[model samples]
Target: MRTFFNIAAFAAGSQALITRGDSCCFHLTASGGASGSVGQLSDGQNRIGDNSLSPAEFCINSGAITDGNGRGCILTPPTTQLQCDEGATPTGGFSIDSSGKLEFQGSSKFIACETGQNGGLNIYTTESSALSNCKPIELMADSCAAPKPQPTSTSTSTAVATSASTASATATAPATPPANNGCPTTLTSGNFEFPHLIVPIDSSSPDTAAGTQFNGKVTSTVSSIFNFDIPQSDSGKTCSLVFLFPKQADLQTSSFTFSGDGKIDFAALSGIATKSTTFHNAPSVSKDLGTIAVSPGNQYVVSTFSCPAGQTVSYEMKNAGSTSLEFFEDFNPSP
Candidate 1:
């Protein structure tokens, strides 16, 4: 059937015609920039508006129609070709490539899917396979749900037996040895120092032999032993000293001994001595502090010693290794 109508007779912005069709197509044309060729189509109980102004443009506005069944329009692609904006070459916005990939052109173009409930949008492939085979790029907020844990059955007697076995095993285990009560684990460059030959004794009288005496000098009349210089107030308190060598020094195959006539003994010292490279411009000879030999290694040699109250002690290096020895004292004694 063919019908013709002059849209100028209708009021401006008015609904000019209404048609009911199951399978029909309408071609609209307008001239002189006229804007009154608006009409409505009835597809069953749904009313679809046809607001066409030019040959290349048409729009459907359903604001005047209401349906509780949530009806919508579907545009099926004929021969797998779909285009927007009169099939014009899109400078930006949405497009589908020949590979069937939906692409958004331009930097600011985006597609936003809004959901009103906790559910999120899901995308799947057209392949006929299990859902697990299709991996989705999840970008939704809090969309993943954790699987619930299943319960297992256990008997009271079995649980009690297992608890008893664990307790018995724990009780039969051997006790662990105590941790090493030693000097600080980390040593810095500042911890090294040139060995001091003599330090003033902590005494009331400078000439007192009791606390201000030194052993016989190794080369000179004046003893050249490395003095610890324990304060008179700190007498009788235990202390520790750590001897360290530079990285260039080898610690293996080196030996050191501490010997002096200050009533001190090697029973308080503990460390390994190792061979090391000779230091440049090192002193030709080093004095002795004690009589006992100490093994040398890369590790620091720790010595725990104490001087009797109102008495003084002197310490000297008897065996200077390949490298010059540097000594540091732990003024803060370990408990």
Candidate 2:
């Protein structure tokens, strides 16, 4: 039924060694001294390494085949089905069907490639386990593109004008100072509008008016607090006029105060009720400033403070309840 043999020595040059069994045969050959050798296993119509003549059931070759047909080693799975296993239980690592299609089995199944213009490629299954366990994939851009141009002055003038007009209407205060003994006799209000309202990008080119106008508005309902930056040129000057307007009636009962660099200047109410308050520059601890009240026609309260160069000052109107409030600032060279 079967026969086996072992040869320890063989002649050099070209030689053909063939062995036969009941259902399988093997062919091995060597040529040109000891340069290279090739071996093939086959069953009548099929060979192991070279599948050109028919189809190799199984074949193994180290170097390229020099046969007249120029064939190499090849392995073909069975026509029916094929399964891989570790030991007893079926692992199903990979399989080939009769049509020569390969399929993979398991939870995390994917194919990865390492060569591409951007990076690499990754393909994953759409199963629930893959979706829940895998991390998100990120996509990248191929190349950079130019940026969009900014708007010109001619196109944005209307919008800038409308915003500046609204801010001037709601934030502008009366020219006259409040009639209180505590208030300074002479004060100056700077012509500069709110800086926050102006757009800095327009200052350079194309749309220049944006830098010249104040077009910002800030409204608060819970607390009447506002902060603004004072330019370096006005550092030694004083903020002579800080005005507050109450949009709702409930704001009348609250008190307003201005503080800079962590020091409180003075506090005032909306009516004629006077209170002794401390001033940041006053030599005495407190002064009897008359109650801070809204002007009859102006409908706003005013306070004053010494401005620090290149620093932000804050004004707070507490106890506003649900009433909305508006605030404005004016810096004067003299006080």
Q: What C-alpha lDDT do the candidate models reach, one value each?
A: 0.20, 0.22
Q: How well does each candidate superpose onto the true structure, as a TM-score?
A: 0.20, 0.21
lDDT (C-alpha) at residue 171 in model 2: 18
Top candidate, metric TM-score: 2
- Determine which window of 10 residues in candidate 2 has minimal summed lDDT: 1-10
Candidate 1 residue lDDT tens string, 1-335: 00000001111122111111111122222112121222222331111122321222222111011112223222112111112222222111121222222222101111212122222211211212222222222111111111111122321110000000000000000012211111121121111222222222212232422222222122111222332323344433333333332232432232223233212111221221111111221123322212211223322222333423333233433222222222222221111
Stretches of candidate 2 exceeding 4 Å from the true structure = 1-191, 195-221, 244-296, 299-301, 320-335
